[model samples]
Target: MFELLHKKINEIISLTDEEFNYCRTAFTPRKLRKRQYLLQEGDVGKYQAFVEKGLLRSYKIDDKGVEHILQFAPEGWWVADLYSFFTDEPSSFNIEALEDSEVLLINKSSWDMLLQNVPKFERYFRVLLQNNLVATQRRLMGSLSETAEEKYLKYTQTYPDCMQRVPQHMIASYLGITRETLSRIRKQLSEKK
Candidate 1:
């Protein structure tokens, strides 16, 4: 159960077996059914979930009722409303299981405990936050400047397996383009190949 967690953490910082065992104690395992809500808008985010199996997405519905996907947490990824998780405030985003998933969850108390007990995790989390920030910045810039085909191409490169897992409409929503536009872009790209 903790194998993926160990691998992910080790990718950032190496840990002894004893240390890894201690780290795994901070998490609680949970299973979510497809389309089930993990965190809902207006609710305070209680836990940050590490995906052990399957997929989940964090998104927000605008007043116009269109969903804008913020991030997709496939296996080995993490998902949470960071603002709400840190501030103990209501989250504007909703986190849902895109498929039946198994996740390891760490609540604020457990997170604090883990960090306090294992200082190396501070560096690990910092690296993760830094990478997330960089990705967010790049995505923002891409949204403002890149053409639809460029966005789709980048998305495909960044998440090579996502196209097979996610539906076309959700992919369009994530790319900030219309479904028809995505289809056109895909067709054009395929024809060029």
Candidate 2:
């Protein structure tokens, strides 16, 4: 049941079997249907989830009520509103399953205990958060400087799997382009190939 979590954690920090077991004990397993929300704006973020199966996304609704996707979390990924999860703030975004999903959720209390009991987890999370921050920065930079075509290319290169997993319009939204523009880009690329 903990196989994917074990693999993901091991990729960053080597944990003894006992440490792994202890860590697993802190998390509650949850299954979400597609379109079900793990979190929503105005809710105090409660838990960070480690994805074991399927796909999920975090997004925001603008003042105009248009949805803007912020991130996609496939298997082996983690998703949460870090601000809410860390600061007890109400979430500014929503996290929902894009497909039926299974995840391991650790509440703030459990997270604290896990970090204390398994110190290696500190390094594991630091690395994970660091990588996520760097990636977010890179994406922000790309969005400002890159063209629609470049954005699409970079997105496809970075997340080839998402094409099959996420709807095209969501990908377009993430790229900051209109869906019709994305369609044209796809057509141009297909013709060249």
Candidate 3:
């Protein structure tokens, strides 16, 4: 369980075995059943979860009760409401398990402590946030400039594993398109191949 966590951390910075062990002390392993809610709208998010296995999604329901998926976290990814976790404010998004999931959870307090104890962790988190920001910017640019088919192709090429794991309708939601549009796109792609 800690292997992925350790590897991910090492990719950001070299941590001595002792430092890794200290960092490990701050995390708690959690198992979430499929469809379980890790966070609900209006509740403050307390922890950031590192996905060890399975999938989770963060979404918001509009006034019409349609779920708009914001992001998906598969194995080896991290998920959380950063605004809610950092500010202790209620989150507008809900994070739910798409499949039975194993995760390592680090509470805000523990994260702060870890950063103080191991300054290198600050660099790790900084890089993580930078990468997330860059990806988000690219997604926003794509949404503004790309056609539905273009978006669909980009998504599949970038996250082919996610297409296999996530449901079609949810993927459509994330792409800001109707399920019918997604089906058409898939059919078009298949025909072209």
Candidate 4:
């Protein structure tokens, strides 16, 4: 269960066996069934979950009942509402399992303890945050300026696995395009191929 966690950490920063053993204790393992919610709107995001198996998605529903997906956490990825987790405020987003999944969860306190005990972990998390920020910024820019076809193509290129695992409507939501628009784009692209 901890193998993937160790590998993911080592990919960012090397850790001694003893150090990794100690670090592993900070996380709590969880199994979520498909359609189950990991984090719900109005709840405090107490845990940052690392996906070991299956997929999870963080999204927000607008007053019009439209879902705007923020991110997808497939195996080897992580998901959390950063604002709520840090500030102890209610989260605006809901995180749900897209498939039966195994995740390692660390609460804010555990995260702080891990960082304090393993200083290299700070660097690991910092790198993750920096990449997340860049991706968020790029997505925002694309939503503002890119055409629906361009956005769909970019999404497909970036998350090819998600294309198979996620529903078309969810993909459209993530791309900020209508479902019909996504269908048309997919059809056009398929014909070109």
Candidate 4 ranges beyond 4 A from true positions: none
Question: What is the alpha-carbon lDDT for the whole of candidate 3?
Answer: 0.94
Off by over 4 Å in 2: none
Select the stronger candidate by lDDT from 2 and 3.
3
Global lDDT of model 1: 0.94
Give residue 112's error in model 2 in angstroms.
0.5
How many residue pairs clash in each candidate at the backbone level? Answer: 0, 0, 0, 0
lDDT of 1 by residue, 13-70 (tens): 9898888888889999999999999999999999999999999999999999999999
Q: What TM-score against the true fold does each predicted structure earn?
A: 0.96, 0.96, 0.97, 0.96
lDDT of 1 at 52: 98
Clashing pairs in model 2?
none
* lDDT of every model, 2 decimals: 0.94, 0.93, 0.94, 0.93
Which regions in candidate 3 have their CA more than 4 angstroms from the true location? none
- Per-residue lDDT tens digits for candidate 3, residues 161-180, read 98789989999999989999
lDDT score for candidate 2 against the true structure: 0.93
Where model 1 places Cα greater than 4 Å from the true spot, the runs are none
